[model samples]
Each structure stands twice: as C-alpha cells, then as structure tokens.
Target: MTRALSHGDPLEGLPSRARIAELILSSRPPLDTYVGWQHYRTHCGLLVPAPTISPRQWSMLPESRQYDYDLYRELTNANLPLQDTPMHDKVGKLIRRRLSSNTRKKDDPTRAGVMISGWGNYGKTASVCSAGAVFEEQWLALHRCLNPAALPGARDLHAPVVYVSTPVTATPKSLCASILGFFRAPTRKSATLPELVRLVADSLHDHGVKALILDDISRLRMHRADDQDVLDLMRAFMSLDVTLILTGVNIPGIGLLREAMWNKTTRQWELPPLESTRIHGLEITQTEHRFDLIEIDRFRYVTPKQIGVFVDHLTGIEQHLRLLNAKVGMLTGGTMPEYLMRRTGGVIGLLGRLLEDGAHEAIGGKELIDESLLDEIVLRRDGPEQAPDEPVIPTDPPSAAKPPQQTKSTRPRNTTFDDHGPASATGR
Candidate 1:
C-alpha cells in the first residue's frame, strides 16, 4: 500500500512543492512562483517557505528522507534529522554551494578575500545577516543562542562565525572599542582603539572565529591614513581566518573592504527588482480558469481594479504570492507604471507620487480610463480642493470614465490618513 505523507516525508522521494496544488497531479510549484519566492527569500531568508517537515512531533515522519534549503534547515532545526522537500532538494544543493563559496572562500590563506557591495536597497544587509544566521546554526547549534561564558572572554569562544552591526558613527577607535565592549565592558575612560583592537584580535584568535559581517559600512566615516588608527582597524578583520562580508548602501570609499584589505578574488552579487508577473502566476494562476477569458480584442495592461479583485479572492499562499508580485512591480517601477516605464529616474527618494484624485475623478460614471477624465484627475489633484462635496466642474471635456460620486470627493475634508495608515508621502 502506498502511504500518503502529511508533512515533508523523508520516505516520500519528492515532497509536494506547493501546499495546495492541482487536485489530480502532485508536483513542484510552477517556475514563476519559484522565482518570485526566491526574490522574497533574498530579503527575508528562512521566512520564505521551504518544503521541510517543521520541527514538530505531529508532523514528524522520520523514516523518510527529503531535501530542503540549507537556510531553511538552519532556521528550523539542526538535529533530530529530517528531509528537504522536492523543489528544495533540487535547488537546495546549488544554494548551499553558493553559500559555501561566499563563506569558505579559497583555502590559500592570503589569496581569497571578500567584499559584498551593491546599490542602495539591493537587500545586502538582509542577505548577509541571513548567511550569518545560517552559518551560526550550522556551527553553533549545540550551544545556547548566546553563550554567557564568552561575556568575559579572553577564552571559551570556539565559534567560527561572528555577526556584528557596525554603527553609523563608527570610527577607527569606536570600531575597535565596539568589539572590545562586546568582549569586556569599556572602562569609565574610553579605551584607545589600539588598546581595543589588540585585545579584539587576541580574543578572535583565541576563539577561532571564522567569518565576520561588517554591515552598513556607509555609516562609518573616519578618513585617516594607513598605520594611523584608520588603516589598521579596516585591515584587522582580514588577518583572521574568518570570511568577511562587507555590506554598504553603495560602493564603499576606495571600494574593497579597505585599500589594504582589497584582494583580487571576492565574489559579488547585485540584487535587482523581483518579478511580479512570476508572483502573479504563483498566487493567481489557479483562478484564471474561473474568469471569462476569450482572447481580448485590444491590448490592455493590468489595472487597479484587476489588482483589487486579485487581492480580494486569493488567500493563504495565493494572497502571499500576489502581494509579493505587487511589491516587486512597485519596487521595479516608480508607482506610475501606467504612464509607461520611461520616467523612473531610478531614485525612489526622488520618485513621483500616485494621486487618487485622478482615480476619484475617473470614478464618476466612467467606463474606460479616458484622457479627459484622467486630465481632470490630474487637474483636481494639482488644483486646490473644491468646497467639501461641492461639485467640481472638471476642466476636461465630458467622458464616460468618471462616475458622479467620484467628482464629489467622498473623502472627508482635511483627511490625512488612508484606510491603510497615514498616507504615504508619495501616495498623496
């Protein structure tokens, strides 16, 4: 008799990739969904669902062997072995190889080095932290989350990974002092950086820490020369056997960790916009059959109405996938993908706004999004508000696109917040 498995069963050669899939056939989630899921995982790491028997007794199916993402394994458990799901079993190995390459580097003591750099909001901090967390779980699962014995450590820290958040005001002295503060609380008198670093290197050497993440490097700005407090601190971490992951909003000054630490062989990855279409396929594809879809007469891109509908009917996995798609599109486009993609100056801080004023005007007894109604929306948004609920005679010619209720501004006067929250500066 074929035993049906509940959770990711090791005995089942392949795990059902998606939680809810086609009734007749069982298989991996579609490729589009996989791509979108990868993007989200790039940001949230283990938070992304991986096919794994969760660390729970009820779901446990021990006799089976399954494959799963290493990051997912690190997140849930390190022991009492379980298996990875099918899709995971396939991609998990590749992901692990990449993770290992970044961590282990090359064995040649001085030859291989590391530098993680990318444009702002490229998901660097999140990625490195995820990597660090995985490495920790892999190496330190036997120990408490944070061992107390290391608190006064000149000793007792045999760990291979170190996760540290470099502060905005970090200087050569402050940076060294920060590491020392972690090892031994700083004195009433601020210990000089040389004093701090000597101890830090000694402590790291004593403990055998292997990898370090210096995140948010843009925050640290101490422009001093080599051998002076500056060069030594930047160069110090590389001396240890630890793999170093340097994260910054943009390329750090002089690129590479520091002039001294720069070596030829570091791997780099730049994160880009996630694919919303893929996400759409994952969450909303199943329901496409429910909709009436004889090939359309004209070309029409997605609309908010369609988005709203997709948001309304989908749930659980479907909903999550759609939201991720929406985010990916927004992240890739500057709000007005409707106006065409040409206007994205690429700086979100300087990106334009999306006003519902046009949406409001267009809502009045309107069929298609006509130019006049759209123009009126633009006018109304740019122009001052008419007396509360007073009929606004739109400057543009009449159109079928707007409903009468829309021109009246049902929105309460002086309203500052949206149904979601205080209005986004761009939304306004």
Candidate 2:
C-alpha cells in the first residue's frame, strides 16, 4: 500500500459554514419547528389549531402544521435569554445580589427590599423568574449530591425562593391568602388578618423560605380604607429575614412598602427602559441605584444580523442559516427591518407577533417569508381597513390566494344621507 500521505484531519477546527449548513438541513428538527411565530400568536391570545379543528384533526395534520399549532398552544414559551443590553445585565446583577443575600448570616437591615419596575414587556418578571429558576436549579443540583442528613429538616421539600403573583386589587386578606396558599399552610376560611399573618410568618420560617418574590405588584392597591393592614403584613414578612423582591409596572403601589421601610433618601433598585426624568413620579434619591434595560434604538431599525442571532438562539444556528438561505433570503438582509419597525414602533411584542404570523404564512404557501407577508400580517394586526401603499408582492400562492379574514363594508352608507340605512333598520 502506498504510504498514504495523511490528509490532515478534515474535521479539525470549527466546522466550515457549508458543512454546518448541510448539518442543519439534515437535522431532525425542521426549520419551521424553531421559527417562533406560533408562540407570538399564542402570546397575543389567539387560539391555535383554531376552534374548527378537533384534537384528532390537529394531531393528524402534517408535522410542520403540528409544530406551529404546538407553539400557538404554548404562548409563554418564548423564554429567550435576557438580551445583553446594559439594563438587562444590571437587572441580572441585582437579582443575583438579592438571591445570594438570602444565605447571608446578617440581613442588611439598612436596606429594605428590591423593587423592579419597568414599562410593559421590559422583562421585569422574566428576569425575576430566570433568577429564581437558576437559584433553584443550582440548589437542587447541590442538594442531590449531598447526604440527606447533612441538611436539616424539610430542605428537600421547600425551595429557597418562593414566587407569588399579587392578586388584583389585593387587600391584606387576599394577599395573605395567596402567600399561605403558596406555602400550603393551613388556615381557617374565616381566619382574621392577624391570625393569617401570624400563621404565614411561622410557616415561612419553618419551611425555610429564604426569598419572596411578589410579582405584578401593581395589581395590589393601597387605596383600601385599611391600608395599614397591608403595611403591617409587609412588616411581618420583612421581619422574617427573607429577601423581598417586588416587581411590576412602574406604578406608585410597586414600592409603597420599600419607601416606608427605607427613607426617601435611600437608594432603590428599579428596572430599565426608563426616561431620564423621574419615572411614574417616584423620586430618584441622590443615592438611588437603578438597573435599566436600554430601549432598542428607535431611530435605527433592528438589523438582519441581530434578528438572525435571535432566531439562532431561539432555534439553532444551523436552522437559522438554512431558513435565511431557503425561505428568508435577501429579505433577512433588506428593508424588512425598517418596514417592520415602522409598523410596530419597535415594540418587542408586536415584532414577535409579526414574525410569528409571517412564518406561518410563508410555510402555508411553501415559500420564502418576504416583505409582502410581513406587510399583510401587520395590516391584519394593526388595522384591516388600511392597506399599505407598497406595491403588492404576491405573498399567497397563485393557486391559493387567501380570502381576507374579514372584509370592510362600503362606507356604512353615511347614515345621515342613508337611502334606507339607519332609519329603516331602527324603525325610527
């Protein structure tokens, strides 16, 4: 055998872009599965598998359709990593600090609690949940490796962090009830506020609850006649030496207790996407420290590279590239960004919705996701009455032009000059 000059290992170093592309197309997970459109529709509260289809029919649909339907069924499924913006990083740090402090020997008596307030879809709740999930995962992993006897009573049963959503217009009683329910602590249906408070406090301590996350705090109103009851309940929880995290819309009620616990001069931790001026009339003390999410630059549209990164993260790098080459094409690198930003005002939720709807329309027609599909989706979402002035790009397949979901009636007959319109209908 001729001594084979060893061809240097072809597989060495990072795989070539073409090789990766081949792997993506060959992967079992289809490109459509990871494209996040269905999740957007579900988030917007649109039903998936539509009401017309039974579960059997849904299951019988092609794999691609099933995948989209599954996404629609699970709207909150979009759990993208916190964007690496300054504000998100700051929020992450604050969350880590709060979580770590739960295990500290001496509580920071000088500091009251953390309040994370931000505009809608600014990731306040997601950040908190991510932190809690991380802590829980790490704690559980460590617990699994250690001996059961090494930990004291109930370590296996109770988590280090407890998350609770504040009930809308939450009175002291309702708030306490939600907390008690979280702990599964027993209480009479008619238990008074004081009794409930005492029971909850004891339960929290006994269960070794280290941190309490009260989310959507804006829902809890302080306008009740007996606001002191709410104050007292909070004081009781604070006395437990557990970390307190209150997060919600940047509303006055979010930090009512934190303000009372620490003086106005004391710094508070706030969520980002805030204006330079005072936010929601909450004073920023001289010492006020805030973790803010930077609003996506409104003037500059989201670039295709940024979107590709997002999709790659959500789905996979290989899948993303495949979509770009196969279905997304030049649109991924074109004026689609400006068009989308113009329609959505760069709102994250709207952007997600547009992508989601566009993805489905593209898949249905077995074609690329293009500007025409995006414009149609936007028009349908924003207002079906108004049509974009762009030259129609023929989104729907030639053989299957989709009928408008709803048609506009001819000018409501201008009721004042109606030939037989308003008066005849009302028998006036």
Q: Pick the candidate with the highest lDDT.
A: 2
- Ten-residue stretch with the least lDDT total in model 1: 290-299
| TM-score of each candidate structure, all chains considered together | 0.38, 0.55
Runs in model 2 deviating more than 4 A are: 1-87, 107-111, 142-156, 226-228, 252-332, 378-428
Alpha-carbon shift of residue 21 in model 1 (angstroms)? 33
Name the lDDT value of residue 154 in candidate 1. 48
Cα lDDT tens digits for candidate 1, 1-428: 11233655432333233421231243333212223222333333223332322223213433332222222222222111112222223323433344465445556453123445444433344445555545656655545544433546343645455545565565676666555444444444566656766777776666555555565655544453422344345554664555555556433333223222222243222222225546654333211211111110111224665333222222111212211012223222333333311221221111112122322232223412233444453221323333321322223324578655635657668756636657688976
What is the Cα-based lDDT of residue 173 in candidate 2? 89
Q: Candidate 2, residues 1-428: lDDT per residue as tens digits?
A: 01222344211332334543453354232111111212221232221221123334544557755554434322212322234443455666776776676556474542245677655655676666666656655655666734333345544335456777777667788888877776555679989878887887776666566667787766654556544456456655776766677777644323353332212243333334335446575545321342222121211234565555433332321122112113322333457555664665444445555655655565435325567766676343332222222211112224766787886777755567647535566666
lDDT of each: 0.38, 0.49
